[model samples]
Target chain A: MAAPPGPESIALLERFVAALKAQGVVTEEEIAEQIARTDRASPEIGARMVARAWTDPAYRELLLRDGSAAAEQMGVSMAGAPPLGVLEDTDTLHHLVVCTLCSCYPRMVLGYPPHWYKSAAYRARAVRDPRGVLAEWGTVLPDGMELRVVDSTADYRWMVLPQRPAGTEGWDETRLASLVTRDALVGVTLPMVAERAAA
Target chain B: MQDDAPPPATHDLGGAPRFRCTPVEPDDAAPPDAFGKRVDALRQLLARKGLMSVDELRRGVEAIPEAEYHALGYYERWLRSISGIMVEKGVVPAEALKP
Candidate 1:
């Protein structure tokens, strides 16, 4: 079993969790479970969404316009919470999403979030310097992509359906799915390889 | 089994037979009781003089978990709470924000 959090952090999180409840963010069990379900890999479900957006133009455009609606096109539903929307990253403006205030994720699509995701460090840093945050995640932005950070709050929520990187023109859906990294889906990480190499 | 659902009246004004939120208050403002519930405790503390609007602050309540927002085991309970608060607070509009 993993070690438990220190008392100071737990106390803070408890108060944090309680505050979120008052704002109508997340609940006790959901918070507990979300904290419990922390993992290294991003949700396989979000990866599938990224893959679908890659080869399908209609789907990609749809995802950019209405994420929740577009997700439904691929069988992922954000119906549990409020009307959630999806946001996409383009060449001129790269989009990165964070609750800033809380961890209001598309829980249905991304599954439970990581512990770091909801951390005050992340919340404060993400808004302050997205490029720095991405760098910490090991993503070095390309020469000319302007990074725009968006705070996903109670009013609006977002998901990043990153553009298919320059490679693997003929790759099938299964092959494409592997290329979609968790970071790419969340907008913090990127698909490093041009295409899925000979793996 | 698909037919198992609470009656529509028990739900929101949408009349779609969804889950219900905890009866905390008039539902116009963020309920004070949510403070002790879950993630909301923090938000309740941080909601300073002009940090945020009632709508934004209310959706911030979503920072909390679902059970405190709506009746447990009621599918779409979370949706009701988030959308309901936003709608009631005029953040998204009644028709557009209806859960």
Candidate 2:
């Protein structure tokens, strides 16, 4: 938006990339493919993991125990990446993730972090007033639910395993996965029964 | 800004009070801006080349002056860190990056 960087600066960056290529540190092909891989890293992977966890108890156990390994088992490659942690949102406890320091995220699984996720307001308020922040994101949990604010402070990135919506008892994985939005996985909102029915 | 509060660090923003309702819209479909992509690619190349470690990049980003830290956007910080680290490490002379 608003033309991020001017042409001169961009030309300088192009020259920088050329220098790197010339040094044999990286190639244009590798950079292109990495960009493509960034695009491929989407919430769909998290959604599929959630859907599988909802349908399979053993998989849910595995997901809760070792998130990175479970993700790999489901064909999501996080090899050599920092450990991924999945927090289970239950009847009494809800998990909300914010990197108050930096915009650390599970980008390997969830594609790009949302703009607000990296905002100063979010980083500051999510820890101070999580309920207020969640309400701003259109999520208002029931009164007295223990809100657990998890910071991505260290090497671990977190994603919330939101509770499965009611009234989707017989739904298949595809149908269930359709209801799992990125925001839901982030614990800012819940998967709506209406969304599941629409699928 | 609390007068009696601890000195502000660049990254310790949790629970610091400045109440403002900043609503965010979903931009999942919008493509990344050109400079953002280039900066990200440059970071990868820099890391791969052993010129900069992810830890070093994080440290550089965290070390950005406090005023600029609040002023810069997400990728802008990465760009600044990449530029700053390249200069600090002498991988590229500062003049080479001058526009």
Candidate 3:
């Protein structure tokens, strides 16, 4: 476990907040609102998009061509966030995303990044040995398949549009969305039909 | 082809060989704890005030000393970067950050 912030560090942060408030630079209400807004985001939003894409070819095209607009079409507000890019996983190729410099996630759709995504171990290994990293996550790709690692830099954030799993044909968007986990959207693992039985 | 590229910063670990052997922990999907949410809220508030941008925040994080950079946790680094940028941008005086 990481060490708790020392009392001195807490004091420093308290002082800084007090200073900002004195200057009218920020308000407590604004900070509370921001936290509430961030809390509203979750993987379920992304799953809704993925399930729609899987069932509707036209929506899938729109998602690939313009991610932000597609997200807006689903009533998600992308007013201040960076452009969202969707990486389509295919039969012969898979894509994994990492930000080697820092964690630049698609927070508007997928909520806050998972703890492991921000770790130095993940940031370094995801780019160098994506296949190995995926394997450690129990996501071994078939031999001869190509693995592409995309860097989610400061300008653009990325999420994977994992291919629709088999045995899910004719499933409605809601049911299909149930299978798309947060890990699948990040490309760390594929959406599995087996989860339905387990759940 | 030019071969004189400068060495990557300590934070730039895209394919550095040293991390190849490090083990990655399993995913923990829990939301950010209370302290982390507070730090994140602070950052969002700063950005809304136009006092800082995400790029500036990233720069501040990347500028941390290598040893300290590795030692700090995720949101700790974020809080450090946010405070540093606030001082650097004159949004907060350096003395205000002195504990």
Best by DockQ: 3
Q: What are the per-residue Cα lDDT tens digits for candidate 1 across A46-102? A: 778778888888877777777778667766544434555666767776788777655
Instruction: Pull out the clashing pairs in model 2.
Output: none
Query: Model 3: per-residue lDDT, tens digit, B1-99?
Result: 158988779899887788899878865764777677878899887887788899989888888899988877777888888988888888888888886
Give the lDDT of residue A113 in candidate 2.
Answer: 81
Q: What is the TM-score of model 3 when looking only at chain B?
A: 0.88
Q: Give lDDT tens digits, candidate 3, residues A84-194.
A: 999999999888888888889999999998888887888999987888898888998878878889999888999899999999988999999999988889898999998
Best by lDDT: 3
| Interface RMSD of structure candidate 3 (Å) | 1.8
Each candidate: what lDDT?
A: 0.53, 0.78, 0.87
Could you tell which candidate, 1 or 2, scores higher by lDDT?
2
lDDT of 2 by residue, A2-109 (tens): 236655556667766665555566777888777777778898889999999999999999999999998999788886467999999989999988898877788777
Q: Please report, as a residue range, the 10-residue window in candidate 2 chain A with the lowest summed lDDT.
A: A1-10
DockQ of each: 0.03, 0.47, 0.67
Structural similarity to truth (TM-score) of each candidate? 0.55, 0.90, 0.95
Give the range where candidate 3 chain A is weakest over 10 consecutive residues by summed lDDT.
A1-10
